[model samples]
Target: MNIMKRFLKYTALTVMILIIWVAAIFISMDKGWWHTPFTQDKMPNEFIASVQEELQNEFVGTMAIALFKGGKLAEESFYSNDKPADRNTVFQVASLSKFVSAIGVMKLVEDGKLNLDAPVSRYLTRWRLPHSDFDNTKVTVRRLLSHTAGLTDGLGYAGFKNPKDVQSLEASLNKAIDADPGSDGRILIGVEPGSEWRYSGGGFTVLQLMVEEVSGQSFDSYMQSEIFEPLQMHSSFYQWDENFQDRLCDFYETDGSKAAQRYYTAQAASALYTSLADLEKLFHLFDEDNVNQKPVSPEFQKLMWQVEAETLGTPIYGLGTFLYTELENGGFVIGHDGKNNPPINTAFRYNPVAKDGIIMLTTGSTNFATRIASDWVFLQTGKVDALLFTMQQGKMIQIMAIGSFFILILVASIAFVRRTGK
Candidate 1:
């Protein structure tokens, strides 16, 4: 009987302690002391609901949507598989890394560490930009960043998958540019720098080389420490190491079939893993007057929003962010989309005017996803001013479960005491 009393007393104390701990957690969460990620249930806006519904039925893969109004999260929702997509569900962002790389390079420009007009050959000690009989010195950092360096995208891909075991940037450039694949692999200057608007992944890669040379740091470390960490984008990082493979969302072919994993090492122009929630924080930079507790001076932020391409006849390209100036009714937004391996299409767009935007990471890289994204944009635009409200529905469920366990334990303790006492 004495043993039974001691057992009940211990059990009661344990249960009470657990209850207090759970209550404290809830209280902290309610007070925003904990990083309680917001889901669609907490979304207050109609725009989020519209996009969520569209993506759920049309988009075949997992996705997360977050909408911002005046730099604040107006609506947020996530619909995925049995696995929930949160702020940490890292997905391969592919070419979107180019945008990030561009930012790093621009920071160099801002610091007066690199010259936009200076020849890239000035920094490179080994092989220079492919001259092919033309002066390689003509290729400048500005030209490379704008993809106007007369380089082809094919050669960029070839160099990335170059057969030689070249560890240094100089050795990589010395590699032969394959001409058989197509003229895209050809690196000779086809036109004057800054004369034409071409999407050259090769040019971006060269920019990566320039960044490495100027900053005196590897591409991965520089961006992680300089840009991502400062922005509080904890989920953003380079795609390296087999350990990260576990957190990776599975990639699919354009047809929604699973794709074989293909690894590449050139990180500057491509290869980044991030989550939709993290992307939203990145876009928030535009809406805010400060980032990382530092004042985002009007002049500096405008440089990011500045139209770098007057010759292209539009504001489609900015410093690091793409100028999405063609939204139907909504004002202009600065954003970019990424496609790396086939079937892994990802995109994030933000509108400073409406202060609303959407971010999606899809495994299947199909035009279908793009179409779906366009439709979602239109749907969200209709309900422009949306509202969201949420109560801790899960808390009630947790409370019930905890209460039931406490009751069961109490009854068992009472019965044990009676049996032993009698």
Candidate 2:
């Protein structure tokens, strides 16, 4: 009898703890713990409701949407994770790392420790730009930011399988520079600098080395001190830790895992974990004054915003961000898309004029997902897509809802039976 009683007691305790845990997640998600003061959530309640309903039907495993106006986060909501993803849900934001890393480099520029026009060799003493007939000296910092440094995005770093897969920064850079000319390892200034636009992930890796050399701190430490911490992006991180592992959402390709289980040594170019709430603040910077006194003057910021590349009298790439001065429909966009490692798709599309933007993070990547994103972009331009407000319950939602339903059933059944009837 005592054993039976103990069993019931322990079981009740376990269930109660789980209920508390789930409720905490729900509350934190509904009302975020970390955020900036808001004017209004950019998206209206009706709009959020409509989208939230539709998100349950989407293909992505986990996702969140944040809307901001003139630098204040207006509305934010997350939908359906295999694990309930609240505001703290973290997704590996692939090349988005470049966007953040560039901020670090710009901080160095603000400190007068680096120059945008200076050759990378000036700071990255460990490994210089590889020899090509192209003048390495022209491979300046500005060119790297704009991806116009005549460099090709070589076979970028392999996703590390484990700690063994990681390599020292010096060794990795040196290998790239020292590889045989025709070998797959070599990354050189393949074209004349200032010739054309080429998206080079490798270029950001170079910037990573440059930042480390100039700051005299590990790349992670430098970013923490300069960008992440001051900005209060508390959960944003480059390397894996227990907290990250607990909050990490799963990623999916069409049929398999698109995200690598291992980490990358190229921390600057890729490898960051963050959330929509945190990212909303990062995107806010494009629209608001740097409240943190980010050292750079307003004029210098204007320089960063200036499009470095041009065609037919139109501007293209801004510093680390892209500049869409004019769209085909006569609208404008000035943000970047990061389709880093597979299955993890993230984006920040800010409308400078409206001082509003979409901060999207998703752990699902597929051809259909791309189409959905396009529809979303068009929707921003006032094109109507039927996606918002429709509920297409994903697996996670069905399971969580079903379990909650069972719990409700148990409670109701217990409450209805009188002691005499029992």
Candidate 3:
């Protein structure tokens, strides 16, 4: 008699608890206590799996990827766990910093503190390139940002020791250009600016100089204050500052084996550390319509992607960013790629048209081999998740709705019975 009574009482209590849960859910959902969602209605699955396989086969290092569509996070993937490359892992973003740095300079332009057409020599009291009778005359902040300054690419990973190489910017700028005067006529005219586009790391370095001179802040400090902090890019940094060492993953070669060094990393050209999550915030700026409101005006961010030049009748590059159009679908995208060292290869690309983008971060032993891996990540983005995210999202919503609905009814019935009878 005692055991039967105990069992009945416990079962009643359990049922009552479940009924309350369901009632609360139904009430909350119906009363607008819960947010109504606009269903995504689409997902792509086959493409996602293929992308993962491609990444495993091609890129030999740890990797993470995320895709956003219509201004919402659509998909994310991680390939390894020892280093555990995730949205929060920061990779040295290399020349991508040029795009970021340029945004700061352009913001200054918008504020009327700097003129794009003004000769950079006007601001530099610390050092000035000897005005070549021809070459240096055309150099201006605008040309430099657009890589039209005619300055040749100088150091790759070969030039710097680490981010702390304390050499004055002037010393680095004085390195000789390999191109002869007038070798490229448009860039050679010592007349005025806005001539032609040439890929110049030296040009970006010049912009860094300009930012320092005008802001009255060190390059790293200025970027932190103006760009990274504002964007909440907590994982991004310019130099290998001591504080960031722990967050920094060891870079690798292509073999997925041993580590690589800082010199092999793209320092000025490619020396930036950032996580995938932060990179998404940076790329989402390209969206004219944004879910996050603090971003710069879409018009201005779009200006970053605008083609700044055409060479040999084809667009070579845009302002501080690479320009590429997909041939199969004619989709247009703009972004950048880098590996701090070849072993730790990284690439980031975003389609402004599709409002879709991806980033791959890897660390390993061989630089060249890592690039082969990097290419696979890029290919995976357009190939895989592009098609699979839709199916997965739809399935998720259906499961949640059915589960929620059942719980709502059971809880509501219990609540009504308790109020009426007890």
Candidate 4:
């Protein structure tokens, strides 16, 4: 009985310690204890130097960065190997394609060719979402843009090394020809529409089909004519052009090895090629005062900023872009980040009210651009954004290790109690 009592006491102690440890971690994260606060007074040169220092690490092969202040380019730089990289250096901007694709959809809406609330099936004749248990009619363009659509194909397209291997849009839709493993490649409604927030690249691919059918042009051609050309984003394209070869930066792996160049048929979801100079033009789209040649009307742009979906009690997504962090003035920092396998990461974030933002693109480094962008937000706002929390793999691993230690202690105590009782 005495041995059993001792075991219970040890077990209780272990449980208490585990609970306390978890509480501490949550508290620390809430307080932003892991982050070093950035002061607004810091000089741009200092920030540049810090970023340059980080770039010296082996994980990064090339990076293009720009800082915007008062809706104007304050500073910009390009870092790379012996290759010639400059403001015109083009990058395959992974999921940032979604931001531009969303704009294309809204342009169609502005033209009265598409309706946000209408059934997406109304727009597409090339393909249809596979039949499922859910109400397919409820799957609307707005829900798909906001990722609240019922589609369950959580696709992340893996571009092909050879252009010949690229699947037709309809064929790829039937089975994501190069999606990441574990994702259901077949595009279909899996849940009740407007039920919850779920990230689905497959949803955007459907929008691509809608754009092509309604515009009576290829997705790339439609985006170029309706969006990129009007913005004077001369170097941005949904599909690769032979003319861009000289400007395209080679992608690389995390281990500093070169990765094969890839091509994509899922242009809306994963195939935007852009330059820093061109992306700067995109940043101005959020600037309400710069209305000379806006892509969408102020009213539609405002609609895009309005919250559409949330995760973990925080409103994290707006119409087609990410609602990153809220400002004290009740405005939000908005942008998007993109990641592709074999190490390419890109991020762009800005506070529209403050007119301050960061644009970062990297090759041979996974999530490095996002971390830096998150840090910039933390410095400006003193609050950690949702993306920062997702990047805390190291902290999570430490917590898991500590919890495992406590569990082992409890197990050992139970063994001791049993042996003594015997």
Maximum-lDDT candidate: 4
The lDDT for every candidate, in the order shown, is: 0.59, 0.65, 0.57, 0.85
**How good is model 3 by TM-score?**
0.67
Error of 3 at 372 (Å): 9.5
Write out the backbone clash pairs for model 4. none
TM-score of each model, paired residue for residue = 0.68, 0.71, 0.67, 0.90
Evaluate model 4: give its lDDT: 0.85
* CA shift of 81, model 1, Å: 5.0
User: What lDDT, from 0 to 1, does candidate 3 have?
Assistant: 0.57
Which 10 consecutive residues of model 1 have the lowest summed lDDT?
382-391
For lDDT, candidate 1 versus 4, the one ahead is 4
lDDT of 3 by residue, 1-422 (tens): 96567556655765676566556654443233443212212342433455566555454566666666655677777666266566776676556667777777777777678887778888777767555556564677777777776664533433344545534566555552222233321112233346666566666666777778898987777777777787888888776666766656655556555464453122235556778888788876666666664435665666666677665454546667665433245433666655344555555667665565555565652232223222332343333121122223454456456765765576566655754775
Candidate 1 whole-model C-alpha lDDT, 0 to 1 = 0.59
Clashes of 3: 34
Point out where model 3 deviates above 4 Å: 1-45, 133-135, 159-166, 176-195, 260-268, 291-295, 326-331, 365-422
- What are the candidates' C-alpha RMSDs? 23.6, 20.4, 22.6, 3.4
lDDT tens readout by residue for model 2, 336-413? 656644566677666666666667777765322333333344444442111211112243355456666676666545
lDDT of 1 by residue, 230-252 (tens): 77877777646466556667656
lDDT of 4 by residue, 1-422 (tens): 98678778777877777777777776577557877733343455667678887777557877999998878888898888646688899998899889878988999899898899999999888898788898888999999999999888989898898998999999999997798888857887888899899899999999999999999999999989988888999999988899989889978888887888889988999999999999999889878888758877778876777899988678889878898888887879998999997688999998988899999998989888998888888887877787887677577668767776867776687777777789
Predicted candidate 4, C-alpha RMSD = 3.4
